[model samples]
Target: MAYLDPRPANPAEALTELLAGNERFVNGTRVHPHQDAEHRAAVATAQRPFAVVFGCSDSRLAAEIIFDRGLGDLFVVRTAGHIVGVEVTASLEYGVTVLGAPLVVVLGHDSCGAIQATHAAMTGTRLPGRELGAIAERVTPSIWQANARQITDYDEVGMIHVRRTVENLTRPGTELGDAVAAGRCDVVGMFYRLADGRVSVLAAESAGE
Candidate 1:
């Protein structure tokens, strides 16, 4: 593994690498790659992470541990609900355009408190603070979509949120979208299972698309 290549040739390769790592984690066979003293020194001068992980701030959703990835493997950004704001977009753009990351992964998980809170807010429970309400507000669309589809499952709402975030990031006018258009990157949305520690793809778009 070229642990220091920020650009991994193509999106498929980068996505595959992440999924493989998740598989390792699922099977309890993680090799803990790129975390040793030597690899640490190798990335000390310059870092070249291959994927940018935009995920929720849920404690159990720790990107590196959940994906079985090590240092210099993933550039990660997190928010309460993985809500995409201006700063999120800018950070992801820097990862793709400046760091040359080939893949962006939006990871949502089952039993997400954010999703539950958003659902509660939709069903008449008020959120406490303006800031937290804002986070819940951002996640409300997914809950609404789920309700429109007659799906009341919290995990499914989380998946919808993941898909929406990926869509928003890769939409026509965004920098991430431009990178995808230019064959420089791709975006994938996935759901993490809290009970089993596995990941499943919910939405994806490649440069080929």
Candidate 2:
């Protein structure tokens, strides 16, 4: 079967689709679109997803489930704390620059263990391993940014990290940055409430700055 995805015209409609899906999820009326065998096979040949969701790797934060998207709707990338490292940067560039996705979402949530550990380490508790320490190191700047505003809570810090992440990807000279500069893409930072199943925008960088 030829799966026909009339791509969103721009970032605004792309975001609307995501928010509407989350509303469906929150209201327990998920349609669960595009999971059939034909859709899977169609996407296997070529995927033109509308958005790239770079989120925390928490089990409860499944992008498709929470956003009510199915195969080929989203190009999803994830990391603990949703860190934007070299690999992640490349993946996002692939999604927007190559696949032509118009929107990039940085999704973070409350009660995140990664943000919690970063907070603990900031408070002088040592991270258990070299890799874990590196993760904390990447998260340090966000906590410091939060501290400048007197915010010490993990969820608040996570929001700060997500916002910082959006800024990084949309700032000048990066791949996503170029895309945004040329009015081809937008980057948005979003926060998810684990208990309420709601996602809200924290910060955004639309096309042309």
Candidate 3:
């Protein structure tokens, strides 16, 4: 894969590549592509990752391992609840604009501690650590949204949060949004199943619209 010419020329192709890799992982037929020492050295000077994955920081959500991709295949961003703060937004912007990635994946998983903590906080529990509490605070809106819809299950709440994150990233006027609007990128919301090691698409924008 040449750094100058990226593979999976379109968003659909990029998304397909990730899905195929995840299938390999799920079937335990992982090829672990691009991780050889030679490929690692080849990408050291430059990287042209095809997708930018913004997913929860859960241990089981390790992007490369689960996606079965090796070096320079994905530019990954992580937060406790996969929160999209300024830094996360900027990093993804760079991945798309600077790195020229075609696809952005927003992944959330089941049994997320951040979701649980946010739910607890909503139920009147006092969180101890200031920074940790702040993380929960960011996730509070999703909890509220779920509650408004009478959805109390943590995994369901996680799906709502992931969908919200996808909406926020692709909303009008943002850098990511502009890219999508111009037919330069595609944003997909995905939910990961820890039990089965599978991924399901929750939301997606086709061809930027």
Instruction: Give TM per candidate.
Output: 0.92, 0.94, 0.93
* Candidate 2, residue 68: lDDT: 98
Q: Order the numbered candidates by lDDT, best leading.
A: 3, 2, 1
Candidate 2 per-residue lDDT, tens place, 50-90, comes to 99999999999999999999999999999998987899999
Candidate 2 wrong stretches, greater than 4 Å = 204-209
Give the lowest summed-lDDT range of ten residues in model 3: 200-209
For residues 84-164, what per-residue lDDT tens digits would candidate 3 score against the true structure?
Answer: 789999999999999999999999999999999877777777553777887887898888888888999999999989988
Better of 1 and 2 by lDDT: 2
Q: List the residue pairs that clash in candidate 2.
A: none
Clash pairs, candidate 1, are: none
Question: Which candidate, 1 or 2, would have the higher TM-score against the true structure?
Answer: 2
Worst ten in a row by lDDT for model 1: 1-10
What's model 1's lDDT at 8?
63
